[model samples]
Target: MAAKPNTVNPAQKKKQRAFEGVCKSLIPFARAAAVIASVALLLFLTPFVGIYNKDIPGMEITVGGFSAALCALSGQFTNVGAAFGNMDIFNHFAPAHCKVLAACAAAAALCLLAALVLCVVLAIGKAPGLHSAAAVLQALAFAALIVSFAFALAMSGTRLLPEYCSGNPACSVRSLAILPALAACAGCAVNFAAALRYRKAKKNI
Candidate 1:
């Protein structure tokens, strides 16, 4: 007797195929979002915000008094002071604290970079395990960014020496420094959401 042909369930097959298409589409989106997030994180590390001289509109006095993105261990502070004249006077005292902040910023950037690489790998391979791993990395990067920004805010209020502004009341911390961090956080959130979406799509398959 001839063997019976294997049967295929049309509805189930169609559902499976749809799930696959969804997963494929989501992978690229996730990858793109991760890349954007990583770039935003790196940009946030730059010294866009800091104390500025009110007397000199364009001059930044005590640059990066809030975050370690520019003045951390890199000695950008010397440059900032040279450019602004009196800015370095206040910033000199905070080198140790700035170094710590710089470390945090560096860690966050590394985490974001790792997550970005993993995201690209996931996009290329479409591995189920990688989906979860990428999501975890995104989460880790976001957490690190948050921690760095938090410390920045704390230092902005507490660590700023009053002596820096005693003779020059014009010196004030700029709020714009936190904006990049906020933007980076937003990017990380988007990337994290995309990763979760991709993971869910995979699970449905």
Candidate 2:
């Protein structure tokens, strides 16, 4: 008996080339996404949610992640005296939601950090294994953030960033606070593309 020679079919070879090209092309995009995620993390620590002070420019009182958590728990929205009573009166009855916002914020930050690490690795080299995982983590980070703010608004009437309160005559809006979510959008899209590319490559092989 003689050994049979193994070879890849031309169609498979073509698919392989396409895969490699796509992956190579996406590297720069991955790096860009990593940088955007970094910015999101930094901004994540800043006060994205707050009430703009009309009397003083830049005096807009905002709370960062943790502080915002506390404010929401305390049912304080504006970070001012009268604002202590700003939360919906019904919110006063529910104490079980305590620490929910803080936990959500913490989860979002941690997930983003982990996703950022994976994105950097993917940007530096071929990390097909990490592509899907990274994409999921980044998506979760954004979702967690949304949940936190949604809870804040429904429970405490807190407004900032994605929350539109500009219509209020006495307050200003921090429209720029939406930057982190924007960054996450970039991060998620790049990783998703990378993941799909790898999946196709594996099937071809």
- Count backbone overlaps in model 1: 1
**lDDT tens readout by residue for model 1, 1-205:** 9999999888778878977776677666666756665665556534533566768766454333224444444556455444333325434655554555555555656666676776677667465345555556556655655555555445445446365555456665553335445544555565566657666766765
Report backbone clashes per prediction.
Answer: 1, 0
Instruction: lDDT for model 2, please.
Output: 0.63
Q: Give the total clashing residue pairs for model 2.
A: 0
For candidate 2, write residues 1-205 as lDDT tens digits.
9888997789888877887776777687678768877987887665544456676666344446645444555655434443332222222332333246555666777788898888788888767568888889888878777766655444333433234444456554342334566677678888888788777766766
Q: Model 2, residue 15: what's the lDDT?
A: 78
Could you say which candidate leads in TM-score?
A: 1
What C-alpha lDDT values do all the predictions have?
0.55, 0.63
Candidate 1: which stretches are off by over 4 Å? 1-12, 59-92, 123-125, 128-132, 156-160, 175-177
lDDT of 1 at 35: 68
